[model samples]
Target: MKVYKQAKIVHETLKRLRVRIDWLQRKLIDASHISTLVERMEGIESARVNKGAKSVVIRYDGKPETRLAVLDFLDRLEPTNLPYVQQSNSEEKHFFHASLNGLALAASPFLTPGQRLALAGALVAPTIWEGIDSLFSGSVKVELLDAIAIGVATSRGDAITALSTNFFIHLGELLEAKTNNNSNALLRQLLHPAPTSAWKEQNGELTKVAADQLKLNDVVAVNPGDTIPVDGQVLSGTAQVNESSVTGESVPVNKEAHMRVLSGTIVEEGTLRIRAVKVGDDTTTARISRFIQDSLENKSETQKKAEKKANQRILITLGLGALTFLLTRDFTRVASVFLVDYSCALKLSTPVAMKSTMYKCAKNGILVKGGQVIETFADIDTVVFDKTGTLTHGELDVIEVESVQPQEWPKDRLLALVASIEEHSTHPVANAVVTNAKAHELPHINHSEVNFIVAHGMVSEVNGKRVVIGSRHFLEEHENVDIAPYEELIIRLENKGLILLYTSMDSVLTGVIGLRDQLREDAKSMIDRLYANGVARIAILTGDRARKAHALAEQLGIKEVYADLRPEEKAAIVQQIKDQGRKLAFVGDGVNDAPALVNADVGIAMPQGADLARASADIVLTDDNISGVAEAYEKSRDTMKLIQSNFKWAVGINSGLFVGASMGWTSPVVSSLLHNGTTLGVLARALSGVRER
Candidate 1:
């Protein structure tokens, strides 16, 4: 708290606070870090630090508690408290190793045969060491095959062949290393968690600090709307926590003192003080996020198969080389036989294709999380979409307004009355009504105390008449309003996928408001494109009623539909589809969709989706465009197609060369050039799209 003692509050307001710090004049503290730290606290919007005036200005949401929290954070921050950022130079390592290998190859013509052989040996030392290590370890792999080939070339004083083979091997290493590094970097960006801070309660006082700084056994205070920062037992207070991210449950669980709580769950209501038993990287959120990050290193089935094929081919090459040398007593044939293995192209082409496609997808506003996701997308047979946000605009709009009794209540007046009542609540349907009324410049009508009912509607007294605005169930059943006369109109609207809100005045139906999500203009076209690209089945899942969900599916020409489902039910359906031996992809955009997103073979999250949804998804569209899913599907197939083509080309040509060398038909120089030439050519084809302009 050394820095805190020297700082003073200079100006204060409901939404803005300015603080003076003396150390900023001397450049002793990191102002950028301070701004980022304070701005992440709940209710804070921005923090600007001024090094010249030695002051920090913070703008926060207009909440009294938020103002207190900002000051608390600044008061507890110390001079030594700043996050350390490490810089990565894998790109530099790639360049440096590449320069050395390039020099060895390019300078070969200027040296004598003996000098060339010596230099090639130095350059190929690592591969030879790896081969010797693998030899003792009793494993036959591509590295051992490559080392033996180069070793035979050197033993026979064939420097050009030795240098050529070693150079191409290094080239493939550089390609795979560079691609893996860049993929991991992009995944890190997409997997970053929401800004987090915690309130540490010690000795009867609360202090705000970065969540990562929390220690085991530290007591933390969490409020409504705050993400819980630890996996621990609640020390005091009570709250309802949404554990959907972990348990896949739609309902928030009630938590009280002595109950256990997990990190990443949000406090929906009330407050709680928790004692942290696990902190920092040990928490569940970090572990799950790490699981996502592990995708960067985990190889896909295609990559494994490629490496397996390469390793299996190594034994064939070694056996052929030994047989030829034993039969003909010729070292040249032995070197040619050893150099003609299919290891290089088979092992390197898959990574090159995967990395190139990832870069392409990123540029096209799609982020394929890993090579595994790309592999899955290549074979995806089924696609499931969340109805509201995935297929149509998540925002509801007023499609039509009709008055049941026009003689007593007109449409405009009904809209205004509904808007006035609905504006008091913040539901999506209510917001649409309020927005439509405002667009027409309608004034708010005076009403009695508005009572908001959960999952029903709004009720109040307007002009001394009991007025209710809600659904058919709320008005007809709950309020005893008679709406049996307009049953046909209701049915027609529901058939068209319009969600209706019924209004009643004094036990009589007065009006109906039809609200519906506007379908994305390209939705149908996107579906058609999916079908054209070989998707076998398409379906929709929604929490909406069966009528509305069916109406949307029919409009989109989709035959399969699941409706009125909770979050867990949606996930169950996804698993069921997957269990049928169908390769499925699920697209979603809400916090409740996390479970299904996780369960699908490949999950695609819309860019505007909630944090948990994006984190759970394997593929994320970086833009709002829904058609990117179709684009990604096409790209994945093309990349896999390229890999397969290269696999065939490598095997077909190298097998011919191996047979020629066994018959002493192809020389060592011809074998090395043709083998490395095809390997480099296919690798170039795989990386053709990834080149920067």
Candidate 2:
């Protein structure tokens, strides 16, 4: 078979690697064979050939030696007629001669005494060498048992048995290492992500800034979801604080003005403005561990327990092999018993499952940073949303148009007249009015040059009449317009939170146009779906006035609302809900609510948010639609289910293989085949992704 003539690495990360193999698309090369061989290489977990791109994507352990080994293996690849590999000429040459030796051993009568011994010795030497190396390590390992098994067969002059056992031992160990390494990498990447940023109060205003920049005695603002970054006394505001990180207290303690708050603690409810007594390494968090290290260093107990069980099972395999030999005095049985190790299947499946789910999340436009984020996301029962862009469209829309004298100045004519004058302006209200006029296909009323007024409305002459379109003050006070008749209509519109724009013809008021920030068309529907899907609690956190914020919440049928909030206070409400044993997922503009996004169990950033805001969040929606929030939550739960299923299948199948090997029901080759077969099977299922069923 033809092999890849050349290779070039294009991109690489700690565990993920992509290489350009220019000759990969050549019809003469066996792409599948190359993939199989590269996957067999130590430290590599998987290899996929992309013929269209003429590249190979490899997942490997990022150790210097492992990376070097991979690079060297591909660089010197040789064309071979071998069944399942494409690698260095020397390795292929050795295996080619070994196969001939294996064939020669098949006809014992044709070989001389010295020749038979030489052939058997060459075939089992690698396995026997590994055994000898392990002997001085002062521990009973799978390597030692493998060597002894092959050695026993060689000593008995069973050349075929010896060679077969040797081959299986090498194959089994490679697969086992690949599986375990892949799983470890998944957990490693999941536990470490990014750093924390907080809001700091300086002078008179709160500025969203990185926590590391604060100095001792600087005032820092702490809110829900915020980890107390410094040891300080509260200058103002009140909050329910969780000091569990430092003091190990389970319940939250109240912190009000003049009360002390320690570093590394979290605000569960309300807000706090504190004077920093300790900052950076001098603070409690740094004393325990640096800020990033403290937050990013985490663990998944599921993987830990699986790993522990896997280690213990290796010893169990050794103990069983020894006991079987003592009971039956059968070398073949003992060798077979030594072939299967649960450590391979048990340790390998978890990471594969995690990586698969992570891929699935990314495919749906949700970027979940790490495994911990996925875990936390799956557990999220409470969702807190920042009011502006998260709940509403975050822009003004023309909602009401009324004419006092409908016969004299029709609603359509009045609206068109105002839009025509306001079209020249670029204010938010003007844009809303002009946009509405376009939607209605209203003809622009021909008017004289529009005179713009700063912070007021536009004035112009329409058909020899001076048309004034502006606020009540501008129309009634400056223009001497008589607007006394529409008193009830203005009050009714004002009570509905609409900003009324008035239009006066000559000196008499004609009509009123109202504008307000409208709710997103999908916002209410998304919330309904969230509750139906499993979100236990939902609340609104806003910088808007209480009346307006509560009004939006009521419109959306939500009860819990935190209104009249500063940017710093938003995350406090998130922390408060999170502290009550409910996992919180905060949806916000992403930048302004930096404190909340950093503090929530899972922070989902809207697509409209700035890049820095998206970077701070655990999950980010690719589209402006808030419906992606429900999609992320649902997908995370499904992924967790897939991981759990993979774990069960791995443990169940490997335990059976372990039993069959112990009972001598399987040969050494068969035991190795079954053990690795189960690993690949579980690995395949993990990569298959979560089926909707």
Candidate 3:
């Protein structure tokens, strides 16, 4: 009823202000009311209340009156007058109380007869209320069955039996709730950013504040081993930042002034001051977290089918129980039939298995977005891979550099001239050339202004002579360079899966640079294993020329190849394959692969992929290992098998119980114990992983 502390200004701007509330008691309802009041005020754009964090961030138009009104409202607010909000810990307390009640009922034999009846009645009260509510709502579910069994026993003067039945059911319900809560908590932890404080710079003085309090343009100092709290640009100092958490790149990148740093990345060595460009929810970490949370909204087809079957079984069980009572004329037999319903196990076990499997997959460096993706992944008959990164290492290596006109230029001189011209470009081929030049310790040559042609190459004047360096198509056709004399060498390189970069000096073909991206070490073995695992077809979809694409496919033993396709074209290929009634899984790791990734039945992304590509993917290989594609498929298939096995056990055991009860071999008490025991057994098996690691 009292404010623990006055509201503190955590963030402020011309049009927004965020205040952290220190409540004497957790007051979610008061926070909600405060948010509503702030939104109703004039000039207020929006107000978000975070009950968990006990804070309200308000966005408003830049007006002095609006700011004054907000301050006045806060100053006059009285916590004692506001509605109280129950804390989340109350749910745990409720569960504890239910557990204690069950335990007390189990010990009822030690109490007096009147005390035993009172305890039984108290335990059955909630079930009766729930059954009546379901009747009014025109729904007959597991609750109705529990109520019927307990009511039948109590009417026959078997209060102990009724209380024991209710206790076991309540215990099962508690366990189910606890399992789901733990699963959800584990998932949230995977995506939630850990709370940390940031050193905020204001007026040339550094003060420690909550990381969430950082606003745009605020400067924060990061030391070695500190996780960067916001996406920002380095203002000063240098460091080697490990970006594996975000980009999945294992190697640490040396970051200096003006370099951009992402949130959630750790600075391995060195210290730096960074200016925040995107803070809180606007940062990359927030976006990934939101994406993960939203992914849970999609339920798998298997889950949907299981839920539907469970509901239908509930109605069937009620009818069967009624028919057994009419035929036998015995209340105990009816109670037995009502006690052994299969719906509870059927409904609860499937989701538990899915969530547990997903958690395991995350631990193994695979991020499956939802249960549906897992189901679909297991069913996929074909897998389409993008060649550049999925099938081969994306990093290009310069294998050969040769001068066509040796009389005019030697190989090293030609390499130096090419590297100098490509120095200003960030293209993969340019990087390969520059890296090769540096490895050979080639001298740097001076060049004039370089003109870059998109998707082709670059042109510049070296030593007062025009020098052109680009793709074969660009140099020969666009630049009118003569490459016919070197056709034999070019053909040989092309056949060997080498990408050629042609260079021309003074309008004459001078040199050719051959670059080759090595196939991933596991690519061939992975493809072989996919086939062995019943993948009907394996194919490669790439933007590379047919010769290059085909050569790699041959090496990997993949028969199908689609070459020289753009982003849209790759997606079209995926659609065409899917139209053939085949479930397809597409694996890719680049910005250009986003469309195809979205178009496929299940998209698998490698680590170190572009943000958009990773976001669009259904499964992410967090370890950057291509082998996870196979591991995911196997895991999903095993998970499905486990679910089906659980289903069979539930049905087989319950059916036996039903027969035994009809023949008067089992009473209501025995039936209730057996039913709950079988269900819990199935749930335990479901929670255990599909296979041993």
Ranking by TM-score: 3, 1, 2
Q: Which residue segments of model 2 deviate by more than 4 Å?
A: 1-159, 169-305, 322-329, 463-509, 516-525, 554-557
Q: How accurate is candidate 1 locally (lDDT)?
A: 0.79
| Tens-digit lDDT track of model 2 for 373-458 | 76678888899888777777678899889998799789898888888888999787888999999999999789999888887778
Off by over 4 Å in 1: 1-130, 153-292, 326-328, 362-369, 446-456, 459-466, 477-480, 518-522, 566-580, 589-599, 605-617, 620-625, 656-670, 688-693
Identify the candidate with maximal lDDT: 3
* lDDT against the true structure, each candidate: 0.79, 0.71, 0.80
lDDT of 1 by residue, 145-199 (tens): 6677778778777777776666665655566555444443433332323335788
**Candidate closer to the true structure by TM-score (higher is better), 2 or 3:** 3
Candidate 3 deviant stretches above 4 angstroms: 1-103, 194-220, 232-261, 273-279, 389-393, 403-427, 437-482, 503-511, 518-521, 589-592, 605-615, 621-623
Give the per-residue Cα lDDT of candidate 1 at 13: 79
Q: lDDT-based ranking, best first?
A: 3, 1, 2
Candidate 1 local lDDT, residue 129 = 83
